[model samples]
Target: MGVHYVEGDLTPEAAAKVERLGYTAVWIAGTREPRLTIVERVLAATGALAVATGIVNIWYAEAQAVADTYHRLEAAYPGRFLLGIGAGHRELGTDFRSPYQALVDYLDVLDESGVPKQRRVLAALGPRVLKLAAERSAGAHPFLVTPEYTRRARELVGPDALLAVRLEVVHCGVEAASPNRAPARRH
Candidate 1:
């Protein structure tokens, strides 16, 4: 699990520090900008820290561009950069399509661009998407989900697909009192 945020830009030095501080991975939230640039910078900074896209909205970026980045990063950093793409929220555009179809199309583009299924992951939660993750990509990288969700997702996705779920850790009463209720409400 990792904490993801949208800092405007992160320097290579800062990215290296993040790795040295013991974070297994550094996740960046993707907007409309060239997110691959960020991945490249972070990968150049760290020797071993993994860089993951929290959710690369398929509606926002071209699949060819995403695929190019995936290959570039894999060539430069090997197993250190993982692409996590998703079918964005429905109300965003006229292209607001069915999640399954959108994902399939996005993957088709990725495949056309030569990005291997083993190197990317889907931002999946529900059963249908999880099955797609099993068949199409490396696995599911579900966000803000519960233990029960993980248990059920495992069953739906089968044992082969990787399940990288996000979980919040609370250490004290004061910590637990914060907007923790909001995250819990989503589940």
Candidate 2:
């Protein structure tokens, strides 16, 4: 399991605490990381725990720069970092006219910059991107997903793909795991 934190909320103590809690990985969710300092800090703060960006928005960050940081971090921390890239919500910018295409081009740049396919992941909120994530990268990372949605994602990605889901715990009169809980839809 992994713990998701906002980039700014991260501190060395918080990171160590997560590792102490037995979470194998940490994620900086919804942050536009044109640089990788946060990933490095998380790595520096923990032992035997992986760090991932979930994800760095393709609209704001340059792929080549992202790859450069990825290479540098890997050189220092090795396999403990996973670069999760995605085209964030189209409503965030006018440049997102073709999000899927933009993501493809960004991946091409990362490929040229030597960020290996296995070291990266993609945010998948829908089927097209989910399939692409499974085909071109290591796997799909979908947030706020239900079991039914995850099962369907598995079917779409096939057997050998990674499906790293981001979820939340509610403390109310919880019905989150109800069989009738509606499948979430995010695109």
Candidate 3:
């Protein structure tokens, strides 16, 4: 299983701890620009643990730069790094016009730059984008979604593409109050 941890200034020591804890992968969420150096350090610290960008903002990170970093990391680590790229939200001051087109163009650039479809994922939520992700990249990384939404997404993406959903766990003190509470109580 992969741990979706926002590695904001995460130390190499902590990354090693994650590996020791038996998590197969670590998903690091970035805002504008992804910390490629940090990712490299984390890979260096751990053995056999995959490190993925929960998402690298397409609006801020240059496609060529991202592609170069991907190639370097792949050479250094080999099948240990996954690049998740996304067009950030409009509320975050990013231009939302033609976002789909922008993402397609970005993916095209990555393709030309030698970052293959299997090495990357798209942060997609809507139907159109999800379709694009399935067609162009390895899979879809949908954050803050319900199980029902996931079921539908799976149907849309078909059986071949990977569906990496980010589930949020809210602590409500009482298990009865939480929607996703387990049937069997833990001691």
Candidate 4:
């Protein structure tokens, strides 16, 4: 797994390097829309590296648009694309009522539009959403989680579902100072 910022340009050259380095996938974070063009560019540049949205916000993107993009990308790239979607945080000023139902509705549209179960993942944190992901989509993508959380998530999703977790690592040597002063790292 690798992290790419939505604001950053994941150039074809950079994507090629990621593939050459033996990384299986490139994950983009805070994706509010279905950035199919970016996914296509990465897939075109690399032979096997899968480009996944760390999360496309369910509230912001239209389900039909996402399904259309998924179909197009699937046709062009085959099994090299994974759509990771999420219900964004309520703190972000979104109308966060009944997120579970909203996600269910979104997945329903995708299903209707031909985005298969194995081609998608859900950004699931709680038990409800994690169960939904396991039942409805491919698996669960949980961010900034601990080993215990991962273990619990795996149990919740069951053995068949994919469980991808985002872990953060911090290197602090003798020279390292405060949190802000030290250069933090993530993986």
Q: How much is the lDDT of residue 172 in candidate 1? A: 44
Ranking by lDDT: 2, 3, 4, 1
The parts of candidate 2 lying over 4 Å away from their true place are 90-96, 171-187
Query: Top TM-score: which candidate number?
Result: 2
At residue 161, give the lDDT of candidate 4: 98
User: Between 2 and 3, whose TM-score is larger?
Assistant: 2
Per-residue lDDT of model 2, residues 89-154, tens digit only: 655666835788998998899889989999999999889999999988999999888888999999
- The local lDDT score (0 to 100) that residue 186 gets in candidate 1 is 66
Where is model 3 poorest over a 10-residue stretch in terms of lDDT? 178-187
> For candidate 1, lDDT tens digit of each residue in 1-187?
4546553666677778877888888777654443478778878878988888877888777788778778878888988888888986645566856778989999998888888888888999889999999899989988878899999999988898888887655544667577767665565
List candidate 4 segments past 4 Å from native: 1-9, 90-96, 170-187
Better of 3 and 4 by lDDT: 3
Query: Local distance difference test, per candidate?
Result: 0.79, 0.86, 0.86, 0.84
Q: Which candidate, 2 or 4, would have the higher TM-score against the true structure?
A: 2
User: How well does model 3 score by local distance difference test?
Assistant: 0.86
In model 3, the Cα lDDT at residue 28 comes to 83
Residue 79 CA displacement from its true place in model 2, Å: 0.3
Clashing pairs in 4: none
